[model samples]
Target: MTPATSNGWLLETRGLTKRFGGLVAVDGLPLAVRPGEVRGLIGPNGSGKTTTVNLLSGLYRADAGEIELRGERIDRLRPHEVSARGVARTFQTPKVFGNMTVLENVLLPALAALDRGGHRPRSEILEHARGLLEVVTLDRQRHALAKELSGGQSMLLQIARGLMVRPIHLFLMDEPFAGVHPTIKDIIMETILRMNRAEGVTFLIVSHEMATLRRLCERVSVMHEGKLIAEGSFEEIANHAVVLEAYLGR
Candidate 1:
């Protein structure tokens, strides 16, 4: 298959499929996200939303299909290789170094990026890391141990860490708003908007928060039992019979 050079998509998957023994986690899933777009991926439990993010972020390999970013094939790349190619992501559960300080958590990615041929000096990296913490409202806890952070704070730190990677082309955020306080959720939403509007970052957000998704996503795609069942605006999706049935059931 050729690179994703058409359709003006920053990220695209064609016939993307994954399986575990006889259980197909993601089946022939096709997805597309354009540059600077806040796209939502939502579905009920076990609908393959997280699995699709895993495939895109290089955490899981696809058994069949092509994954492309900016016309470059990335499905075969390793996790770090994918990050080096400008794809970054956060997990469904906050993943941070519990023993490390909040600032350190964010700083580590910058140092790693430098090792991978980044040109910025250590001082600049530090500044950038601090700036991101400020954006996520974690500057006050910069010196605190990551493990000390509350669940909501940990999610904020994850966002800061994800942003620490320079030149992030696509950020796949999995369940970003799940279980966070309303205030923290607002901060996360604001940060997403700020990144997308000011820096032109593209986001594929996976969340069950339909209300928040309606406010944040320009478009949305729905998945069910490993297959995409619908794609459109929130309005169209809300009224879609298939979507309603998938969530509400027969």
Candidate 2:
């Protein structure tokens, strides 16, 4: 049995597997993310990187294996249940309430965080929501409709919403740099790093932008055919034979 120990790591998945009909989308995989660490997951298309994220976030149920977040079993819970446990995630395609104002979009989740019996007043919740917008540099856009924001602004809003929840421990972000302008990408990167450093939140980032991942993550895991084949620092994975072969198909 995998020992239940926090050990400063925020997440640990052992023998995680998922199958879609006859196809195995995720093979037996074991992965861990330490608190305040920015870990990257990378692979060719359909290598199960996103599937792992889905499973971790409770968007999809795993076929087998255990998922422990801070030493607690959470593999069988629903998405909201997972979120309530201090896990929040953003998708490859950002999902925001387009009909709502930017402040409201973020405020909803923050408000939900209060549903579990909190004594704070409503004004405090709204202030916290605005603070998250400030962190994402979107405080000026608070009253703007979500659909009025540009692509990069939309992505930032999604991230801010995830963080609006009080004490969000880990964020599983998928393709956060996708469709974002270069300058805005830097803003997003800075936001993530700053949040991790300042608040001690952990991150499991799944991104195709290799250069950005290299700059951000302390360690990276490479996957192929639904299995993690290589894991190391940026320099090590760049020159790894198997990783090169997986990318080069040699």
Best by lDDT: 1
149 in model 1: Cα distance from truth in Å?
Answer: 0.2
lDDT by residue for model 2 (145-206), tens = 99999989999998988886555788999989988999889999998989888887788999
Give all TM-scores, in the order shown.
0.96, 0.94
Q: Score each candidate by Cα lDDT.
A: 0.90, 0.87
Which stretches of model 1 miss by more than 4 angstroms? 1-6
Q: Write the per-residue lDDT of candidate 1 for residues 1-250, one digit (tens) a residue.
A: 1123477889989999999899898999999888888999998999998889999989999999999899889999988889877788999889999999999999887788678788899998899988999999999999999999999999999999988766788889999998999999999999999998888888999999989998899799999999999999998898999999999995
After best superposition, candidate 1 residue 103: deviation in angstroms?
0.7
Flag clash pairs in model 1. none
Of candidate 2, the 10-residue stretch with the lowest lDDT total is 1-10
